[model samples]
Target: MPDIFFNFLACPLGSYCPLATLNRNTGICEPYSYQLPPGQPSHTCGGANIWSDVRSSSEVFCSAGSYCPTNTEKNHCSSGNYCPTGSTAEKRCFKLTSCNPNTASQNIHAYGAMLIAALATLLLIIYNCSDQIITVRERRLARSREAAAKVVKEKIQARARWKTAKEAAKKHAVELQGQFSRKFSRKRNITVSDKVTVLNEEYTDTDGNSYPSHEHSTSLVSKKSQSASEVEEIGSSPLMKMINEIEEQTFDSSESFSLEIKERNLKTKKAKGKAIHTHSQIFKYAYAQLEREKAQQQQNNNLTFSGVISMATNTDYKKRLVIEIGFTDLTVTLKGKKKHLLRSVNGKIMPGRITSVMGPSGAGKTTLLSALAGKTVGCTISGSILINGKSEPIRSYRKIVGFVPQDDIVHGNLTVEENLWFSARCRLSADLQKQDKVLIVERVIDFLGLQSVRGSLVGTVEKRGISGGQRKRVNVGLELVMEPSLLFLDEPTSGLDSSSSQLLLRALRREALEGVNICMVVHQPR
Candidate 1:
């Protein structure tokens, strides 16, 4: 009984064990299985501990046949290498002593108590550190989730912007079609040029007309300005009133009329007809336009025209700048600093071409562009600017000209799409619908290849944003959305890479091909 008590209290390396016993004679620990109660079958299990105790009867550790195994058979009573006490890892043989019935019971108890204290200390350490490890892992996972969500949001915004642009493009197409239909259905066609009067004058015989001797008035126009008072004075003149009352013939400088003289008229000899060099294409286009207009008027109650000019009216006249800008003896002197920017600078900016004013950084390239564009407000500008054979007035042609300065300013907080949309609204007429403005913005976005980042914020120096090249394009696009005929760009390729510069120049050339006279002040060779 004492042996059982001693074996139960002691364990391997003096650790406590309840299901094992120490064997005597030879040193080894073994399990003690409980025998079944009388009349109770072993197969019939009951409560959990009672079942485990019943199963222990069939197993023992380091016991062979009827004797305890040798140190060789049991693998150790070794020195220096300690046994592992882990629940599931491989365990090595441990140093052990022979067991006795009642000897050294107190020493076993003391070592067993120490083992329990060490195990409790290890468990306390693990419990304390677990919270810090869990917190760090959770923070890493949270950062990953936030990054993923940001990418998804950007993708969604890009898709929505693309959808809006597509819809606006479709609506603009329909609007253009309706405009063409209305414009073609006109009865008395209006002249392409405003404030023009045509009067074809021909003379009859001297006796037949009895007026100024003339076969035909070939002069395109008289120096007399057409005005309300001029028309009133011509109509209320005494000579005109007297001639109308007596001879039944009245003449006005601006009017065409005829009178008859009975068989007493003189004939004027015909002058040699000048060989008119009219290009067939231009004449054919003009004639075809007139014929189509007549047909549309006849068919649609004098409300529409047909195929434009001759081939087709593909050009949007308002959107096209067809001016041939010529400058003579242009000079700019800054009176504030008494600096001469340009001296006797003469140049011509032709239609469908790119004109560059190249010079060093401190040169007058920008000054010349400002002078020709009439953007030099405070500076002394002495130049004559002629647009398509007519002298352009500084006040009148200001709207027709678009200028993008070197330092292109933009709102940083707004997105790329918003920036462009606001620019379109600012320049387009109030009569333009919201959709029309969106369409213009979309066109500018596509032309500048900004569709990918259209939803991105235009960040500034203090914040993150697009690349420098893209921002430069946005600056140019703001002016482009206005669709002015004549466009001036100052250092458009500034802060751009080679490929981006190439693309920007290509867009400018494309605009020039569409009849916009482009003038650029570039420092680099463009």
Candidate 2:
């Protein structure tokens, strides 16, 4: 008991245990676990009643016979061991006398208690310091967030102010430019030169009339003036003075010969074949040239399209399915089960032949075409389309095929040649041989009989509007320029007249005979 009591009550050398402490100020005992080892028969069997701290359960030292410290069985006291308070050295530790505390033992216990109290105080100080540091970090983060928000708000305001300033400046600049333009126009009136009138003299009207009666009557006038702020309100520029002098001399000379000039003009304008030209005639002739050039350009572009297709067909002489279109167990269902647009449908297309998918207004003919173009078409398609003996999911084969849509895809403002040039540049790969592009474009123009309207606009012109057939040809031409083996046309003759439609189909047949695969959808055809 004495050995166990001392072991439970005493403190380790380097560290103090809170549970085994004795308050030096209060002189109180703190209950703690005192451990025994298995090496010695009894806990207090050693000669000096000493136990190694390394063999004990915890570092706490306590008196013997109290709650023993827990550890592996090997560390417990053995049954036979030497006793400290025994008559012979052979007696075991369990036979030893119990420890009885006295005033001296209590004093030592109080000293250990003071050391433990000091350690606790130090731990509390460290905890306080860490909490303070965390608090400071939190405050800094809050301040940083506030500063960042302020910066973002300021930036937003700056951007808004900049945008407002830019808009105001743009409006002011446009107004200033408009004012400048009006002032400039007022300073310079329309001037007609003799060269303009001479160019117009060659053209004759439908009635075979040579020119208008007032072709030569109009004359140029010159004025001399000064601004309200400049030149003392009297002086004009020297050039203005010279023009004014010439106008005066011309006006005086015209008065003497006015009657003769009028009669001669009347006779010349009325003549069946007059050689003289007027201002209006010059304008008409220039406009005609512009129209003719436009028509020729369109024709040239059409030839380009046809020529390339012919060349591609000649190169690839195989008759295969460039595009195979079908739908198996296909269905398009709306949000609710209320309506279904397309049901399970199937179709196929082969090269060197035309396969027509016929149906009424809402028969999904166009929808199937769109599906073949490698689009979802807002439907579920179970089957696949095969290309060149391989099941090419529709999306994969779209690269090789060419598609011409129903509507005329064109920029009405641009001339015919401009359209073809843009298409060639956009669609043709940069690495394509240049000679091929030239030959293909030229051949297309000649094949489509577009030489006459090669330079014409696709839309209505002043004296001549392009025929519906020609516009359709250009539409077809745009696609043919790419030289795809498989071609798909949607509603090729939907809104065209019989004659125009026939001409277009004939062109398609001619292209097919030349070994180009053609496929098109038509409303009604013989």
Candidate 3:
């Protein structure tokens, strides 16, 4: 009988099985739920057994805050490690994780917090670096534009010099040619008369004796032919020779200069057909446009009134909306003091014209402008204001209106171009293209003669920058860049010299020619 052996299986390593019974149906142990009591066969069986898998309440696994490595062994979780219930081995905590002794699980909140802090720091660094990069790029572009503008100015000067030299040479040549013709004709006449006299004297004169007329005539003819040959050898007169030399030099220079200009223009046209990706190309286009405008202005200066009207009618420029402002019995009075600032003033500001309001100190010029612009405060205005020959509030067309104050209202810290650009960006139509906006700003800069100081700061009281006259122009430029249809200016030329005042007026005149209604007050006109 092989010793009649009987084998009893023990519990697994990770589970406890005391007081177990075999189930005949399932062929497995039943009620293997309690651990063996220490130092006794069976005491109270207080705690549940440790097991990898538990199916019923009686077969509960190990509790939390402890780990079980074997059926009969359990240990509290160690430091730097965490253990869940029924864990066979402790898990080491990750970096920045909190795992105290006897802890159930690792705490990874510190890692999450560190990750958030690092992300925030990275974002801040990116923001600052991006801003610095943008600033540096803008500064480089500004320097490039200024250099290009300087080159354009030099080219303009060269063209002017060439034109002047050409004109002077032409005038001097004409004068010299006239003088040489007169001198040569006088010499020829004297020689011809002497020959005729010698030939015609065949008979004796009143006091002449019998003489050899043929011999005298032959000798005189020989002398006359010799003098004529001598005159022919002399070529042109000395003055005429100098004039010819100068004309040749000037003509050659002018031709070369013209050729250069033509080549540049061709290059510009070619560049225009393609995309302008460089600052130099952009400035070249601007220079070409400026040259065209100069030519147009010269033509306009020589045009009669009818010719100007016809030319203006034939231009391709899109007409802006006309704004004609008329006021009837306009009266403004102080609210509290009952003092009349404007007493029943009547006037109309028409499109395509400049209306100047001149008065001494204490006059109501500024007050009237403010009232017309619908910016009057603390005053009672009683009148009817008409817009486009209809009774409409001036504020209705505020978007198309502009008003320049007596004082220069401009940003002191920003450059002149920057100031104008800001105004144009804010006030120009949202649908306008970026190139068009740039053109408007540049046009204002050129018209106001602010190119030299475009990049210079407007300056504050603390730090001086451009002159007062330049600042005044910049102030007006702010409004001009917006392409307003109705403009009101208060003392725009007050602090400027005669030339600056004339320049401002000329710019305004150009605006007026574009169908803008302009009304300005001036203390003194130049």
Best candidate, lDDT-wise?
Answer: 3
Tens digit of per-residue lDDT, candidate 2, span 287-311: 3333333443454457666555643
Candidate 1's displacement at residue 28, Å, is 99
Error (Å) of candidate 3 at residue 362 is: 3.5
lDDT of 3 at 44: 44
lDDT of 1 at 71: 15
Could you tell me how far off, in angstroms, the CA of residue 200 lies in candidate 1 after the best superposition? 91
Per-residue lDDT of candidate 1, residues 1-526 (tens digit): 3334433432222122244333443323343333334464443322112111213432322321122232112332233223322111122332343323212111245557778999999889878988688667645544543354345456556887976875565456446545644654331133212214333122334446655423223232232333334545745766445434433222241133222211112211111122323233222222333333334335333323543332134332225647788888888988899778888887788877888878777787887887877778667977677778788665576666889999857678887877887878778778854434544665577567786788788998899899888999998988888877889999989789988888788678657756788888877874
State candidate 2's TM-score. Answer: 0.37
Better of 2 and 3 by TM-score: 3
TM-score of each: 0.40, 0.37, 0.62
For the record, the alpha-carbon RMSD of candidate 2 to the native fold, in angstroms, is 29.2
- Runs of candidate 1 with Cα error greater than 4 angstroms are 1-321
Tell me the deviation in Å of residue 206 in model 2. Answer: 99
Runs in model 2 with CA error above 4 Å?
1-339, 460-465, 513-517
lDDT of 3 by residue, 149-259 (tens): 788788888999987987887787788678867887888898888767764574445247656557786788688788777666656457657777877877788779636
lDDT of 1 at 173: 49
